[model samples]
Target: MPNNIKFVKESKSKFLTTKEYHGYGQILKISDDGIEKHIVVKPKDPVFGITIKFLETGHPQFSIPDVSIDETAIMLKNLEEAKTFCREFYERRDEFVQDAI
Candidate 1:
């Protein structure tokens, strides 16, 4: 957690279901000076997704698609190109799946 971070609650409506929900989030702490900072959070798993945190506060700014399958495929292809590259790089790789980006 950064020193200049704060959490905020937001009310949002669920699409289709038409239900309302309250979510907790954080963002960079705003100072009296009125300056805002940029915060970026990258999830470990590109396929699952990533969360972006605003620097002005610690709250989550937004979520991004992981596209892990696509990215990992590309990575695997690149690794294959290098014959000397160890195949172990992708073996038993399930543990590396990241839920956030």
Candidate 2:
């Protein structure tokens, strides 16, 4: 995770944003059920690699990999592409989410 990065909700939007650090990205909450699902992006390395994750909340951590969920990533090459895709993804969330999951 990037240091000092915090998520703040965008005005009239369902997603969150963090300032550019190594890379920039968005956080989209996709579920409100028992185990909330959140889609977030973060840098994979020294600022270039971008990784998107489909996160499940309210679940107890396991010692080993026991369970799994479907469709957990939105892979991108660099910060620029990640930034562009974040915009596009936010604009077409419904379409992208359907394909993503």
Candidate 3:
């Protein structure tokens, strides 16, 4: 991931821009659920070389500490929002890692 890269929403559309680090590429997916946004990212594990990790099926963290339905998730209603969220989510945190085996 390139540092401080910018993503812009088109005047009447949306788009995604990417940057390469070492040799890994970035990917983003955005979705809507009538009331919120969902941004999902699959990044290559730096410690394991360029092996991009993935989930076989389902929300990879379905077994995390249970919470009430009031829990909040970052909502990305479109492509541009998703791209921004991906950049922030990956870069802003160190211990907040999300992974599934």
Provide the TM-score for each candidate, comma-separated.
0.23, 0.30, 0.24
- Please report, in order, the local distance difference test score of every candidate based on alpha carbons: 0.28, 0.37, 0.31
Count the clashes in each prediction: 16, 0, 2
Give residue 45's lDDT in candidate 2 (0 to 100).
45
Candidate 1 ranges beyond 4 A from true positions:
1-39, 66-101
For candidate 3, write residues 3-86 as lDDT tens digits: 442332212123332222221233433333434434444433222212222322222321122334453221112223334434
Which residue pairs show backbone clashes in model 2? none
Model 2 agreement with the true structure over 1-101: per-residue lDDT tens digits:
22322323332224432222222443334432223334545444433345554323322121111222331232332435555545555555554345333
As a whole number from 0 to 100, the lDDT of residue 69 in candidate 3 is 45
- In model 3, pairs of residues that clash are 37-75, 37-76
* Model 1: residue 4 alpha-carbon error in angstroms: 20
Candidate 2: Cα lDDT at 101: 32
Kindly report which residue stretches of model 3 are placed more than 4 angstroms away from their true locations once superposed.
1-24, 42-101
